[model samples]
Target chain A: MRSVVIAFIAGTLFGLGLTISRMIDPAKVLGFLDVAGEWDASLALVMVAALVVMSLAYRLAAGRSAPFFAEKFQVPTRRDITSRLVGGAALFGIGWGLVGLCPGPAISGLGLGLPQLAQFVLAMLAGMAIHRFWFLRKGSH
Target chain B: MHNFTPYSALIGGALIGLAAALMLLLSGRIAGVSGIVGSLLRPAWGDWGWRLAFVAGLVVAPLLVQWATDKPVSINIDSNLAVLVSAGLLVGFGTSLGSGCTSGHGVCGISRLSPRSILATVVFMAAGAATVYVMRHVVG
Candidate 1:
């Protein structure tokens, strides 16, 4: 119960951060990507600030043997750079460039009452479902 | 530089970090939005509640901000339905295959100094930049 509450609060904060930063705006994101033409590196500054704080926070979190409400910290252990990793990232990048709406901003935009964003999200859901179906059929993780 | 927002960007980023930190400290989670959504797509018995709550929180954020500041969050996107649909599909497929997105790989994974995350971020960022250049420059 408490875990759920905490998750909700965390999510709210994350969404708020994205909103206040104007990252939910595709034009802002596109500007950041426009390195050769009127580039805006402000978002990079955001990422840098986030990285610094998260690194410190991670150090503190690691010191604790267990979480406050959970028994263990769930961390990804895989370190290999598989083909899927690179290829999929490339695909994701293309998609991000095409629409300038990564998952975080897109999901955050759900309540923003935008028809274009709504269409993107619905298509995203469809893509997720299709990917899952294809993965199950292949059974080759 | 007209749209530059360094102060808000940094402050909002800090808050995001704080949120990620809070989630990790309190619940032992990475606050990976994509992973969270993926879990909800095929939910486990003990997992659905928190996952749903988190998504609900995400969905409610704009409303909260509007109520608090009396401002509508602006969203700029490609208006072409074909582009939007294709972009959404690719994002879904790619994030799933890569196993993370900006939140997971960009924030949490990179902060941990994981090699995979580093490479993935570099690849994606470069690819995104290249795609933008091609679309706006080479073809334009």
Candidate 2:
């Protein structure tokens, strides 16, 4: 219950931030990505600001034994550099560069009632299903 | 220097960081959108509630902002149907295979100084830039 509320609040804040920063705008994202033509450095500032605050927050979290609602910190523990990580990230980046919408903006944009966003999201889910069926079903990372 | 919005970008970024921090401190979780949404595809027992709540919050945020500010949320998508569909498929598959996306690896993982995340971030950024270069400069 408390965890759910916390999750909701966090998610809301994230969405609001994305909107306010104009990160929700695919054109804006593409502008930042367009290094060769009319580059917009605003998104770089977004990354810097987010990193500054998150780094400090992580430092604080480092001192805590457990979170308020959960008994343990749930975080990724993998360390090895695998082909899967590299290849997957590359593919994801290609997709992102192709259409300036990643999961966060794509999911948030659902509220706008846009048919295009719906189409993108449905296809994304299908892609996820494909991954689950092919890669996950094999039981190998 | 096109459409540069420094103030809003900074403020908005801080807000995102704050949300991520609160998520970790309050619930012991990473506010990685991909991980949150991806796990939902499998829907394990006793774990789908908060995930749904989080997604619902994301889905409702733009509406809430519009209602509060009396201004429609700003957004733009230039890609046609084919591009959108293919891109969506790639994103879904890649994020699942990679185990994180921007929020996960770019922000949270990097902040934690995780080597794996740093590498993933670098790889994705490079790939994204290269793709953009090809499409905008060469192909388009």
| Top of the candidates by DockQ | 2
TM-score of candidate 2 on Cα atoms, chains taken together: 0.97
Worst 10 residues of 2 chain B by lDDT: B37-46
The TM-scores, one per candidate, come to 0.97, 0.97
lDDT of each residue in A1-141, candidate 1, tens digit only: 998899889889888888888887888988998888888887897788788888998898879998889999988889888999998889889888887888888888888778888888888777777778888899966
Off by over 4 Å in 2: none
- The window of 10 residues in a row where model 1 chain A has the poorest summed lDDT is A122-131
DockQ of each: 0.80, 0.85
Error of 2 at A10 (Å): 0.4
| Error at B108, model 2, angstroms | 0.5
Steric clash pairs (candidate 1): none
Show where candidate 1 strays beyond 4 Å.
none
